[model samples]
Target: MNIVGQLAPLAFGLAVIGSGIGVGIIVGKTIESVARQPELQGRLSSLMFLGIALTEALCFIAIAVAFIPFPKP
Candidate 1:
């Protein structure tokens, strides 16, 4: 296998790891905000979900890109 083939999986793994961290931070901050302002819980939760969806979408895109065939030099 060439460099691109070997690196694809590593790149996808990094993308997943980054997505997980992104999700964790989003939830943690959302919870902290809700704890401080109970009334804003509804809005904060919606925004949190939006952030998670966007982050996960990025992972999915990375997966798609990883599967694409790269031309040989």
Candidate 2:
């Protein structure tokens, strides 16, 4: 039971890992782009935030799954 409990969250963690990596990359690139083109910060920031929201939704789904009960044999 302990092993199963541990493994359950691992699955959710794995799901969030991809979204985390992608959000990190997206945020980094957005920062770089804004740095290079400061004049476009207003436009770029909005789109960047929108993308971040979508990416974070994946992690939120994983978090939801983490607390949900799974059927056992």
Candidate 3:
């Protein structure tokens, strides 16, 4: 009901949006790389998954942080 409460959700929304963009970029680049060199598809795919996992982890961390109770000023 206060400013902090309102901003917490907004921050989480931004985090989610960022994660989505990060994932899109990762996949798009990976596809481009694989298209250029079909033989490197295996390596490129693994790296892409790693990047996506790390990117999604940010969203999870944001969700956890948003639920933490902040001390009232």
Candidate 4:
């Protein structure tokens, strides 16, 4: 197998791990802020969802890349 074939699993793993870490951080911080200032809950929730959506976009890209046909040697 060539480079793309070799790296696909690694790339997919990194994509999933990175996205999970990102989401965890986003959620943790959002909870901390909301706890401290309950009045900002609405704005914080919206921002959290935006962050999640953007992070998940990377996952979708990774999935697409995984589906690309590998050239036959």
Candidate 5:
């Protein structure tokens, strides 16, 4: 098997895992901030959603890459 064929799944998995971790951290911090300042919940929530969208985009990109054909050696 080609090297890229072997590694693509690993790369895709890592990308998704990393994205999940990033989103988790963002949500955890946003929740903590909201608890500390209820009045800022709206702003915090907006920021959190933006963060989640951006983080998830990485996983999508990784999936796209996984489907692409690897160059011939």
Candidate 6:
């Protein structure tokens, strides 16, 4: 297989892995914050979702880049 073809999948996997780590950290903190302030559950939940979406978006961008053909030299 072509090197560039191999790289696309590698890049996609790394993007997903990176996003997962980021989402986990954000959600973990949100959970901790909610535990400390039960009444702020609603607000914390929204913030958590926002973070997840942003992180996921990064992965989507990576996927797009991976699929893109390298520019002609």
User: Can you write out model 4's per-residue Cα lDDT over 40-63, one digit (the tens) per residue?
Assistant: 999999999999999999887987
- Model 3 TM-score relative to the real fold: 0.90
Compared with the true structure, the alpha-carbon lDDT of candidate 4 equals 0.91
RMSD of each candidate relative to the true structure: 1.1, 2.6, 1.2, 2.1, 1.3, 1.4
Give candidate 6's error at residue 27 in angstroms: 0.9
- TM-score, one value per model: 0.90, 0.68, 0.90, 0.82, 0.87, 0.90
Between candidates 1 and 2, the one scoring higher on TM-score is 1
Look at candidate 3 and give me any clashing residue pairs: none
Clashing pairs in 5: none
Q: What overall lDDT goes with each candidate model?
A: 0.94, 0.85, 0.93, 0.91, 0.92, 0.92
Candidate 1 Cα lDDT to native: 0.94
TM-score for candidate 1, please give it.
0.90
Q: Which stretches of candidate 2 lie above 4 Å from their native place?
A: 1-6, 66-73
Which window of 10 residues has the lowest lDDT sum in candidate 5?
64-73
Query: Please, what are the lDDT tens digits per residue for candidate 2 over residues 1-73?
Result: 5565787778787878888898899999999999999999999999999999998898888777777776776
**How well is each residue in 21-64 modelled by candidate 3, as lDDT tens digits?**
99999999999999999999999999999999999999899888
Clashes (N, CA, C under 3 Å) per candidate: 0, 0, 0, 0, 0, 0
Least accurate 10 contiguous residues by lDDT in model 3: 1-10
